[model samples]
Target: MVAVAAALALGTNAGAQLYSTPAEVTANPLVKGFTVSGLTLSQGQTRVTLDLAGGRLVGLLVQGQGAQEVARGLVLAWGGEEKNVADLARSLGAEEVKAQARTAQGFAEDSEGTVLRLKVTGSGNAERWSAYTSLLIHPDSAFPTTANAEGNSKAPNVLRVFSDFQCPYCKRMWDTAHRTWAAQPNVYRVVHYHFPLEQHENAEPAAIASECAAAQGKFWPYADQLFSRVEDWVPQPNPTAKFVEYARALKLNVGTFQKCLTSAAPRTAVRAQYAAGLKVDVRGTPSVYLNGVQMQDYSDAEEAALIRTVTAASPSAAQVIEARLKALR
Candidate 1:
């Protein structure tokens, strides 16, 4: 592990030090899961840093430049004030917007959560701007989690999908599984798992909020409301508000529901799911695995072929070999 010197926040007049390498930046205690380099903040100054090259913050990269252009754009975006960004901000919720903005252009850590000062550059004068932003990575305790859904007692070969409440692909997969389950009720069991992406800022919180409801014995009802109208909210600017509406639709004790959204344990469990996805190389939504064998695509025909191969201990095993040869050809 690369060692990090205690980093002073940006603008603090703390002693100058060399970061010198990428490994150092990655292992820094102050930095969470983001890239850092090519930027400087004086000691005691706060800023969030990100991997610009990674296309990680494409939404806020200012290809356009003007005096105070970035800062002004941020303020407008932050307050649901800017026409261009407001729709997105409102859809994503103000908190999510701030998270997106703070790390939009790498930020540095300080007494505050990761923060960054917006300044317009490229003009030799290094023109400074005033708009600032902060991104909060809730305490680890705030992530969402799952308590095994009770009826999962159906079978040992069950497959569970902890999916995002707002993801479009999740809906399609749910439908596909529903149809498949109806037909193959004895062959497979489907369980749901929640893995909300960070990019879908509201997703994690909403998932945690739902899981909290689940704790209170309302999870399936809440999930039904979310998935039922998921299509209506797709490509819309604010999926979170729609989720709140779904909560209201379910009459899920609004006060308790909101409290659940902010709860730490639920959030922590949600983050754990995201981390688990990363571990399994799940790059997108609707990823599924069968008995830990990731199911890329197995139609009924393919499944039947495998079942036949397994059940029939043919004396020749020759047909299977010939079939394999034909497939390779």
Candidate 2:
């Protein structure tokens, strides 16, 4: 976390409230299988997991001690669910920790906060469910973007993105998906989260700046400026002053913004958002969740394809949007 404040900011959702609780999610006739997230599991650590059919969720679970292993696990899990841990790790064409080859329990939740405890009791030919370690339960509210995550509020389709300010790929997603679908306020909503990558030296500070900008209702504008000029502040040893300049340029209250910077609040908020991203298995920056089904790719092509697929498969309006979001959430 940055000592002062995060450097970059995100947006305000201009879209509709759409589905939050489970009742709002109806079955998606076109989609087969489902991913039930917020299923709390422990590996000496607690993590929110997506429950897939056939005990496949166990395969996607990551093992080991380091953050790098966790990240690698997420990348592999993004490939798709596997029958067991072995398949999950090796099938992705990268070898990591092998599954513990043991029985385990997990849990899932519904809209009303009902908890469903599950277990991977058997193994190999007799395997009932493929699991690595412990299982637990959590609330449905654990998912979904924060209220500050901004975009079109009236739109039925809520697109949540976890992004890094310095990531070029993230910028591409903003240009292609955000600006495009966001243009249609009635149909699409956007919620943004910051996931500054570790390698991006200036990413955290940039996030802090954007967060401060948001405090004064200049989030989107400040974000735009930061994105447009990543090179200017990225290489600086300390972009703190440059970030304040962005505030000044945007006519934000420099005094309050500066004060906000000196406090740890903005940085804490930004890191909280980043932690939220990890809980949902965000493997990479610019991870786009349109209506909560992560887009396979962040390009305009995937965006169009996802929109078309979701639109066609969904019943009248974007009701399926809620279903998908609920499933992923």
Q: Pick the candidate with the highest lDDT.
A: 2
Instruction: Give candidate 1 misplaced runs (Cα > 4 Å).
Output: 1-145, 148-156, 182-187, 231-241, 298-301, 304-329
How do the residues 1-329 of candidate 1 rate in per-residue lDDT, one tens digit apiece? 00011112122211111111334433444334333445322122223332211211111222123323443233321222233333322322344333433353522222222223332333434433233332221221332235634333454344546578678778776566545654565656555566786677556656776776776678777776767776665456756566667777777677777777777877777677777666554666765544433344434445333322322334212233233223322
Question: Candidate 2: which stretches are off by over 4 Å?
Answer: 1-140, 144-147, 300-329
Q: Give lDDT: candidate 1, residue 228.
A: 76
> Least accurate stretch of 10 residues (summed lDDT) in model 1?
1-10
Q: What is the Cα-based TM-score of model 1?
A: 0.43
